[model samples]
Target: MEQTLQTSKMVTEKASPLSRRVTWYIFGVMFSINLLNYLDRYIFSSIANTVAKELHFGLDGIGFIASAFLIVYTVFTLPLGFLADNLSKKRMIAFCTILWSISTVFSALANNFLSLFCTRMLLGIGEAGYYPAGTALLSQHFPSSQWGKVLSWWNVGTTVGLMTGFILGGMIVSTFPHGWRLAFLFSSIPGLLLGFLVWKFPTKDTETQKVSLNRQLLKQASIETIKRIHQLLHIRSFVMLTAMQVFAFFFLGVTVTFMPTYLQQKDAFHLDAGTAGLYAGLMVVVAGVAGTVLGGILADSWQKRFAGAHILICGAGFLLGALFFAIAMLSSSFLLFSIFLFLTLFCVNLYNGPAAAATQQIVSPAMRSSALALSLVLAHFFGDAFAPSIIGIVTKYIDPTHGQHFILNSAGQDLRLSLLAFCPIALFIAGSLGIWGTRFAAVDQENVALPAN
Candidate 1:
């Protein structure tokens, strides 16, 4: 036993420096890609009004376009995630980046609704492989103790990308003759370059043995994949966590898709698209940065004293976010609404890091990608996949007689009412699930053979 201990200590000491360097390197590259990923994804929403007017699409049509991207994205996540588990994640990421970038460029060339929808579908296919592969790679590099901080920092890429997308997209549309198309064209360039960079980076493959693409191996892999998914479903904590993600993402999807348009069209605000976009972008960046950093730090600190601390933090964030957002919707004063909006964004974002870290902690390393894949499938499909369309449908129902000549102010009222009815309910349910899931986190973590911190 003494000899074994001595050998283990020696091995750990030798691995530490190399591991730390590799961890940071991977984080840097993945972080950049994540940022680009969201920037490309959200460009359409930032310029939603311009696109809708140019293409002659109704509110429902606009929502459908967003939904199409998410639907394809959700559908492809599972199969692509399976590929990440069995293949070279670095190569997969590179290929995905290139494909998506090309699709973005194609979006710029699209002249009508069908063409644009097809390009968005292609964009979804390209982006589908990124999150599972990236998150799985990050989980492999860091131990559980550091997961919250690392994942939180990684998620900063998302908020930053969102801010850039909104501000940049707005600027392009306001400044250029064909700004929306130009925005897509310009965004594609960086993604193409990033793909090359990711390809050149010396990322280590997590899979121990490279399986050949033979019929026999493919058959076995499929069988194993099914069994693995089945096993994931049995984990009570994971199920609850996924359930929470569904509701949380639903709220997010609806807000991100329409909030700028809401500000621009509403009677109370009635700001132009560019100004609305800039304000909304600033709100997300300022509030998101502060909240994400605080959430990770607070969860990590609380974890030292209690089990399932991350879950508790997430629960609080959801409940508080719900309350603030509801107040923001109701308030007539612009200043009060902005204050509440900032608070709402901050509270909603608090879950970004902790939830991701908790997912990694509760699962074994081999199953991490699959676990995330399943969560994404459920959260996105049941949550955000239809949220925008549902909101649009609700708006149409509330003002059915508007027809082809819908008044902007009336449209805004319909949207606000729909959002007010749904967002709070989903958030409340998410919070309740988080609280309930805390009871299972300790046992779930114990079941996994986690690496030593």
Candidate 2:
């Protein structure tokens, strides 16, 4: 009987998707995966200064190293995204989780910039594989009416992961010698364990052999994919949303990558690394969590009355976020900076739920994963992928500043100038695009409900 059950569970069936109990279970697994995904990816931010010191990398090298992961991440998103719609999402997520976890282990062993950069690239592959698949799976499980709330919960996982990554990275680094490496090793364990759980999750009877699933993919998948891509692009709302993601991620990359170090600047907060990490983590996570959850609830409520509520909320959030972020940047008072920083984080995070839900809603159920994957490919590539490096280059050219410990010419000035020049303007663009997206949302989403040709 045990053998029979094991064999039965390994086959895919075209029945009701899942029971309520199993649905929640799968949600738990995907949520956990999303959380760990961000944590592992951004822990590097917390330890970047320390690693740069040892590796003799300046701001440019630091930014370049950060971009390495994004480049590979961008490269892999579409292929895995294509597979997610055709293959077993659970298994693919499992494979990605395990692969990235092992890669992170190797990151601990890296002794040079090149070795570490290579490991980060591997990490990117895992993360890129998980996101679209996870989002697609959840989309199928929930009603469109509930998509905002559901994805908001998913976004919470991402926020928490980022928080844990920074806080843990700081605490561990402060507590132990070579703590940065240990942080990598420690974080990898949870992902390794979670990967196995996702692989075996929900039921034994619904699993499909990867090889068999491959045979079921579109016959002329390349041509089919292109057609689908073109179809999605024809939707004016999708185009506007994609444009929003580009600017949003770019400025987000600049701030997330450099803010911790910014806290350590002599002319700024002058906090130690551990303190800096804690403050950054707490501020971002708390505000991010509140914004994501509230934004979803509010958007969903507003959507009933307005066709473009998602984009409307996102536009408002970005505008408010820009204001607070700008205040944080220009203020000399630590108190005012901290307060505005919190507001900035909250406002910016408001986009998470509405934006994610919008993508899922405006496309056919069949194209959910592919649409998101393609969007991410473009978003990260043009946005965060090069943001760090570009900002680093800008910072590198600035004149030096004298400081006590860990001073590197004018590195602080470089980071400050780079952030100020780009962040507000980027948010302004994203906000404008999002607001314009509202005009087309009702029409585009209506098309998704039409009968298939």
Candidate 3:
């Protein structure tokens, strides 16, 4: 009976396009939710000045508040990722939505840094399960032929979410005298509503081998799960891919965390938080979306000719992203700076779709969730977990005499310079890792057994 169930699952995975479309629809809905995830996380930085003033916190305190979420997000992602493999993806997303949504609203109500930190941590617990579950659900639902395109569409949510949060938050703060809190509060509504939409949608069962309902199924062992994760890690491709993820995320974390402040300080822009967010969001929408779609299309097409095409593309993107970011940071003209930032975002997203698809392709269907989770763990651990805090520390050390006015416009110049150097360094490492990843794709493919469907 157990063997029959496993075979049935395999057949279903192979033969069902009709059912797969339903998964895509859900992917679209969930993708929108993902956008909100980032919006809530990112808008804080855009309005850092106002938040710090209102809360009476220094740069270190602000960094701690921001880092709190990433720390929780990083710590919980591994366990939640494991749960995603074993549990219902739909339920996981729904419950997490509620958790983060509530925390987001509570963030608006916080009286002190500690209160805000606690709320962010709770939000992290909710968000922690999202990526692994979302990735696994999409992979299971989509066919191999369409995985790159489908994942690319899903990836659009990140840009959209960041843009929406920035623009919307910025608008609210500028229009209203005391609007930053309202902006955070407003961002939570869409997610809470989306949670309802997800619950109403029919959920597909996880494509796992069947276990005896009459026996202790919950306690059953999963040799395949352990073996697959072990094999994926040992694969040189996976290792290098993970290194690439780490580098990409590190750059992403630092840039996102600091960009708004840099703009205000370096450009001498006096725009309210919402206006700054609007500009940044527009850049992401224009550049980030284009890069993601193009990358997916290129990877899908290029892979037919070159076995390591995806990694090579990623390598090129990272190198370009690094170069563009350095130009953006150093440019004296703000318009030219914006152009560079736009190009940098474009370059970064160019590699995202291909990298994700390549990672899954090199793992078996049954183990793809765990494999991706492991990749995420390594990425977040070495990348974002310490990023915001590190930037804050760097700022303090670079210009310690800036004193309590760390939130002032002048202090950000040194911060931007430090980040300019650090971000490029991380991107360069990621670019090199991408090249290293390409070399081992053939060997990795041998162990994971690509999908026949």
Which has the greatest TM-score? 1
TM-score sort, best first: 1, 2, 3
**What is candidate 1's local distance difference test score?**
0.83
Residue lDDT tens for model 2, 1-453:
343233222321233367888878888888888888889988988888787887777667778878999889999998888778767887888999999999999999999999999999999988888888888777766666788898999999999999888898888887888899999998899988899998887643222224453433556567767987898889898889988989999988888888887787776677777998899999888999999999999988887767688888898898888888888888888899899989998999999989988887688777888889988988899889999999877776663432212344325655677788899888988889999899988777667665678
Clashing pairs in 2: 9-204, 9-205, 400-410, 401-409, 401-410
Candidate 1 residue pairs in clash (backbone atoms < 3 Å): none
Instruction: Tell me the RMSD of model 1 versus the true structure.
Output: 4.0
Better of 1 and 2 by lDDT: 1
Show model 2 residue runs off by greater than 4 Å: 1-17, 203-219, 401-410
Please state the error at residue 104 of candidate 2 in Å.
0.7
Q: List, residue by residue over 1-453, the lDDT tens digit for candidate 1.
A: 343233223322111234577668778888988888989999888888788778877678778889999999999999888878888777889999999999999999988888998999999999999998888877767765677898999999999888888888888888887799999998899888888877876656765356767998789778988898898998888999899989999999989998877887755488776887798889999999889988999987776655577888888899898899999999988999999999999988888898888787777776778788889999999999999999888877877675342444447777789899999999999989998998887667666643556
TM-score of each: 0.93, 0.92, 0.90
Runs in model 3 deviating more than 4 A are: 1-24, 209-229, 266-268, 450-453
State the weakest 10-residue window (summed lDDT) of model 3.
Answer: 4-13
Tens-place lDDT digits, model 3, residues 147-216: 7777888888888888887788778877887788888888888888888887777756566653443335
CA lDDT of each prediction against the hidden true structure: 0.83, 0.82, 0.77
- Residue 13 of model 1: what lDDT? 12
